[model samples]
Target: MEIAGTLRTAREMGLVACTSCTRVWPAGTERCGRCGHRLHTRAPLALQRVWAWWLVGVIAYVPANLYPMLSTRTLVASQEATIIGGAVDLARHGNWGIALVILTASVAIPLGKFLAIAMLALGVRHGSALTGSRRQQLYQVVEYIGRWSMIDVFVVAILASLVQLGAVASVSPGPASLFFALSVIFTMLSAQSFDSRLIWDAEREGRRA
Candidate 1:
């Protein structure tokens, strides 16, 4: 039995939830009987894994922006376009909607994910102005949107596949395409490495203090 308006977490009630199967068990349980996965009140080395993957993503993103994402060769001339430059060219060619989508998915969303994950990681470590529920929601959003970070890569791939006209005009993915893809992949790994339960633990500790 529990009281109304005074919610209690499973950890507070001497229970641990399996990270894999989401089954609840007593706190001292070493492994989940249902799934046979090792159980813990919180993920081990969660912050370290998050930061490591985040740093790699940031490193990859630099060259991804500086180098050319797409190389176009035509009988007349050759042109190379970076992520932003490609979007700008598209906009200049009156494809405003597509340009906007590319910018949002490639630039804005990835940057937001980096910042959000860093904030959540730091918040659990030191302290945060946001409430636990808010932090939880932020984490959920970061995880949910991570998969879409590859939109830029997919766009480049599609263009490369479609724009082959026997040397008259051919578009191909450049070096930045690989870096951009790695950035997206590492960013997703960073988001996945985060243990959202830490947010609740931090809140509990705050309440006790």
Candidate 2:
């Protein structure tokens, strides 16, 4: 009954897990043998760093949406297209499927990452309706899918590189390309800064309260 009366976390049990190598070690071990990353039960000042990066991500994302993502120069004239504008043009040209893909990758994924990171950060501070396991799963999903958000950047790069014809026609990345890349980078850093142990800690605290 005593054993069943309470649960213990990895930290409470004197275990620390390595983030890089996923190796488990007894607490107080200085580094992981497999990966050499310093062992700690939870990341120090996790929320502060998460918020800082998140703020950067949000700021960069604003410009990513407002500015032109790509510019095209032809024998006739020059044209610039924002992310939404590019998608709309694609749709107008009867490429609805590709437009939808672009919209989902560029807009939906970035916003989803921001919301998921914010929710995880907030959930640690205040209890959430989502179970700890569920939120952890969300965190993993956000982390895994983060790199794909750069699809728009890749598209722009490919177009710019392939379309250059030395006065005939050319495509070039716009200012938004840099901002979009930065937004994705910062958001990914924000997500990585989070300490997943805090999710279970919150759950335990809620149970106790």
Candidate 3:
């Protein structure tokens, strides 16, 4: 069935969906017969969970910026650099490509995911000019790009592991590395916890009004 040319959602058609299996059952069914996954018309506490994880991610991000992400010890001296500081240092040395990659993966992607997830949450409740399909696409993009945020952490870890020269030189991950990794993880969780069905719900309600 279609309403105002919008296709009907499963919930409107009296069906429950298994998120894990992508199978639909009659509305009152308890679980998916094929996948044994519990069925719900929508995820419980979806928005609340997103906000909770988002808050923790934000908290972790504060320390991530304030602390050093890399620590180096050489026979002559010691040095440390935060994420942005390291990227800038790389750019100064004409390693512009590496600096750009670090900045984009560490800074731009994470911040963009945060903003996108927040907007998706708010849009579901209050509505927006974006169509339902556009909102869904934004959610998919958030989920897809989130894992790349770990590139900086992986680089730091690999460098730390490879550069152990006893007395000559050593590289170690700094406090900020842990915090940055945590922030990326929590934000990924936030993105996963969103209920995309709500996007269609909001659209349906808008058309009816």
Candidate 4:
């Protein structure tokens, strides 16, 4: 836990940061003068919040995949399409690019996010074989790509708005849209709740006792 050389971290330099405003303050300063927020070097319950939101995301993701994602109404009849069904429909219509995008954003992305978040949480708990830089890049990737998962929702909204024709046909979002949106939101929150600083701490201090 001792730095043998001259290198030092903020903790070693005897500094603390305001969790709310992100303003650096002397370690002993009572509160952030600008924001009036209590200052701490780190979030008090980072991992707990991460896990809680992760579970919510996982639960929401189940229904999101299971239920219909889009509903269509025509003079003939009504049709409901789940995510996979929608993608397959797109592919059948020769819109393979759109179908591929939908699958990647809705299905592949959420699964990738779940795995990535799980790895990040577990990496710090169990000593990571990955270099800090590699792990940091992975974290950055996971954080950056999360917003793209809403492509399915956006597409449905756009179609619902643009394809409304009286007695001809109509498209609307279905039950799964809400759940998918919730899942993406919860996963984003879970990713934000993680403390990237802990990634380095494990390298310096070794695994938790």
TM-score of 2: 0.91
lDDT of each: 0.92, 0.93, 0.92, 0.88
lDDT of 4 by residue, 104-133 (tens): 999898999999899888998887778888
Winner by TM-score = 3
What is the C-alpha lDDT profile of model 2 across 43-81, one tens digit per residue? Answer: 889999999999999999999999999999999999999
Give the residue spans of candidate 1 off by over 4 A. 1-6
Q: In candidate 3, residue 184 scores what lDDT?
A: 96
**Model 3 — TM-score against the truth?**
0.94
Q: What is the alpha-carbon lDDT for the whole of candidate 1?
A: 0.92
In candidate 1, what are the lDDT values of residues 1-209, reduced to their tens digit?
65634787767788988989989899989999999999888888999999999999999999999999999999999999999999999999999999999999989998999999999999988999999999999999998898998888888899999999987999999999999999989999998989998988888888999
The weakest ten consecutive residues by lDDT in model 2 span: 1-10
The regions of model 3 sitting more than 4 angstroms off are 1-6
Say which prediction, candidate 3 or candidate 4, comes out ahead on lDDT: 3
Better of 1 and 4 by TM-score: 1
Sort every candidate by TM-score, greatest first. Answer: 3, 1, 2, 4
User: How does model 1 score by TM-score?
Assistant: 0.92
Residue lDDT tens for model 3, 86-116:
9999999999999999999989888898899
Candidate 2 contains a number of clashing pairs equal to 0
On the 0 to 100 scale, the lDDT of residue 13 in model 2 is: 76
- Clash list (residue pairs), candidate 4: none
